[model samples]
Target: MSPMETGLIGIGALFVLMVLRTPVAFAMLITGYFGMLVLEGSRAAGAVMLTESYSTVSNYNLIVVPMFILLGNIASAAGFSRGLYDAAFAWVGRFRGGLASSSVLGCAIFSAVSGSSVATAITIGKVALPEMKRLGYQDALSTGSIAAGGTLGFLIPPSTGFVLYAILTEQSIGRLFMAGILPGLLLMAAFIGTIALIATINPEAGPRGARVPLGQKFRVLVQSAPLIGIISISIGGIYAGVFTPVEASAIGAGLVLLLAFAMRQLSWNGFCRAILETVRTSAMLYMVVIGANVLNPFLAVTHIPETLGNAMVGLGLGPYGTLAIIILAYVVLGMFLDGLSMLVVTIPIIYPVILQMGFDPIWFGVVAVIVIEMGMITPPVGLNVFVVKGVAQDVPMTTVFKGVMPFLLAMIVSLLLIIIFPQIATLLPDLMFS
Candidate 1:
């Protein structure tokens, strides 16, 4: 049989494994290993598996993942996430749909540190959902906002999605992080506007929060300063060229640990738990990376990406037309796959086509991240929605999904703006690096 035919069968087996409830990382690994063994000899297949596994584990860039994850886990254990939510609520809660807006803001802030959508959603939803409920906010709006807002974890700086994308596409992590900034803020603003519109249309859906005195607002902001300061120093250092992303992550984690100890907020038990959680999460991410690395060799041997790129060029649909088609395919995949799985699985195939179409890789990273973010709130496999549902146990899954619709539309609008004017994603990186 031809190599291309073997590759096609391997792809089918990968999907079948996923449908059978096998873990995504294991499924990819299994499919790639067996496909390679069949195409070559057992020696070549074993060498590929061992070499890729070692290289992936030893990769310096990957160190950033564990550090930032530890920073977030430590921050959450120390109650710094709660401080951020309080500060956002104090400042914005008085306006119409203010509580929900504050939730989005809080998610955005926490996302800067967490870099995981599930972590961001659970952290903020725990704080914001109860308050919105107590204040008589509709379940749809309150839960929806948290689910959609958690998606910022994938788009904002220090994003795991961008980290993996950069590693896969051989792009700069700093440039990708910088590219995400404006687009992230644009999406955040769009989410806020969606909340305001919902409240405007149905006053009862989101009532105005009680106004805080100016002094109190300042006090709450002060209380939230430690986490904010760490985020600024770490993420800011990257943009300022003061440090590499790995160094920034180390500094951030160290600072958060110091703050937690100084405040007496993190006990010995809490510290141990944070370490354990970080190891578990980081290990899972590492496995996914290893699987992708192994699978990539198999795909190359089959000439699949090359063949797909050639087919796309033959279509003669201009750049934008081809882009629209790629985005549509991503949305369909997002409905079934989690963000990281989707990234590791598809980028190798789609990336070449993107570059062939003359689109900037950095800009496309931002666009791709946003599309993945949309998937987090999309139905069926909406991971963030499930996270929010876990926090707000009484709220039904359907209500959370309904609440995310407007924000989903907002995402589409923000995506269109970025596509029409690519500079929104590229400007900061261009200015900073140039």
Candidate 2:
């Protein structure tokens, strides 16, 4: 059979396995190994699988995964999330719809520590949802803001999404981390603006809360200073050339753990729990990366990506037009696949096309993450929406989904602005690294 024919069949088998509820990592592994066997026999396939799996996990750069995950788990266990929310609320909870805005602000701040979107949503949602509800804020606005804000986790520094993208595309993780800073903040602002618009249209949706006194606000900020310091060290340290991504992760994790110990907020059991959770999450990510590595070789042997890229180039559509189609595909796939799955499944195929079009890899990393963030709040499989629903159990799924819609729009606008200017995502990395 032609390589194209074999590649198409392999892809079909992959989707079938996914539909059967097999884990995406295992599905990719099975499809890739079996395809390699068919194309190059058992000996070659076995060697490829073993080599890819070993080399992938053994890579020094990937240590950042566990370190950063540990940092987030430790921070969550130590109750820094509550401090972040309190500080944001003290500063923003007084304006009309300020409670919702505070939720967004808190999520953005917490995202600096926690890289997982669900973690950000759950952390901020636990702290902010009850307060918003107490203030008579509409369920949609309250839930929507948290869900949308949680997505900042995917776009901000310390992002696992960017890590995966960097590894897969062979780009510099530090540059991608820097690139995300501006766009992440821009999207956060868009979400805050979105809440204000919702409040303006219907004042009852978001009533103002009691204003915080200047002294109390300063006190809350002081309480949250450790978190602020951690963010500055981890993200700021990287930008300032003081730490590589790996060093930054290690430093961040150690500091958060020490802070937890100093505050006596985390018991020994809680410390062990954080370590165990970090191991579990890191192992899962490693397995997925191994699967992607194995599958990438198989796809290369099939010449699938080249064929796809050449086919795309032949269509005569300019780069932007082709980009639109790719983004649209992500939108459709987001309805079914989680963000990481979408990245592992598509990046090998799409990234070659992107590079061929003369786009900067670092910039595309930001663009791709923003699109995935949109997916986290989109319908049918909006992971963050469901996460917020889990927190706000009394809020209907429909209301949560409705609330997320405006934030989703804000994300789209943010995406467009980044596209039109490009520098919003690239300038920081260029200035810092170049």
Candidate 3:
């Protein structure tokens, strides 16, 4: 059989494994190993697997994964996430739909350290949902805001999605992080606007919160200052060329650990749990990287990416037309696949096409992340939806999904803005680096 045919079959098997509830990392590993064994000898397959596994784990940049994860885990354990929510609530809770809007702001703040959608959702949802419910906010608005806001974890600076995308495409992590800044803030603003419109249309859906006293607001902001400072020093330092991402991550983690101990909020048990969770999460990400590395070689042998790129060029769709098609494909895949899995699997194929069409890779990374963020709140496999539902146990899954629809529209609008004016994603990186 031809190599392309073998590649097609391997892709089918990969999907079947995922459908059968196999973990994405292992599924990719299994498909790649067997496909390589078929195309080459057992010796070649074994060597590829061993080398790729070693190389992925040993890569220096990957250390940021565990450090950032640890920073977030430690922050959550130490109640810093709660402080952030309180601060956001104090500042914004007086506006119409203020509680819900505060939840979005809270998620965006925590996202700076967490670099995770599920983590951001769970952290902010735990703090914001109960308050919104008690204040008579509708379940749909409160829950939807959290779910949609959680997606910012994927778009903001220090994002895990950008980290993996950078590694996969050999783009600069700093540049990708910088590129994400404006787009992330834009999406956050769009989410806030959506909440305002909802409250304006149906006042009862999101009641105005009681105004916080200025002193109380300042107090809560003070409580949140440690995290805010750390995020600024780490992410901002990278932009200023004062530290690389790796150094920034290490410094951030170290600072968080010290702050936790200083506040006496991190019990020994909590500390241990944070470490264990960090290891588990980091190991999973590393394995996914390894799987992608292994699978890439097998796919190269099949020339699948080359063939797909050729086919795309044959369509005679100019750059924007082809971009629309690619974005549509990501949206469809996002419905079924976890965002990270979608990135690792499709980027090798789609990225070359993007470059060939003269789109900037850094800009495309921001665009790609926003599309994946949309999927995080999309139904069926909406991971963030499930997370918010888990926190607001009484809320139905359908309610959470329903809640995110407006915010989903907000996401689509954000995507369109970025596409129409690529500068939204590229300006920061260009100014900082150039």
Q: Which one wins on lDDT? A: 1
For candidate 3, what is the lDDT?
0.93
Q: How many steric clashes between backbone atoms does each model show?
A: 0, 0, 0
Task: Please give the ranking of all candidate structures by lDDT, highest first, separated by commas.
Answer: 1, 3, 2
**With candidate 2 superimposed using the best TM-score fit, by how many Å does residue 315's alpha carbon deviate from the native?**
0.9
Q: Tens digit of lDDT per residue, candidate 1, span 65-165?
A: 99999999999999999999999999999999999999999999999999988899999999999999999999999999999999999999889999999
How accurate locally, in lDDT, is each candidate? 0.94, 0.92, 0.93
- Deviating ranges (above 4 Å) for candidate 1: none
Cα shift from native, residue 419, model 2 (Å):
0.6
lDDT of 2 by residue, 1-434 (tens): 98778888999999899889899999999999999999999999999899999999898889888998898889989999999889988998898899999889998988888888988999889988998888899999999999999999998988999999999999999999999999999998999999898899999999998989999999999999987898899989999999999999999999998888998999999899999999989999999999999899889999989998999999999899889999999999999989999999999999999999899989999999999999999999999999999999999999999989988888889999999999998899999978
Using Cα atoms with residue i matched to residue i, what is each candidate's TM-score against the true structure? 0.99, 0.99, 0.99
Tens digits of per-residue lDDT for model 3, 68-121: 999999999999988998898898889999999999999998999999999999
Candidate 2: residue pairs that collide: none
- Model 3 TM-score (2 dp): 0.99
lDDT of 2 at 53: 93
The root-mean-square deviation over C-alpha atoms between each candidate and the true structure, in angstroms, is 0.8, 0.8, 0.8
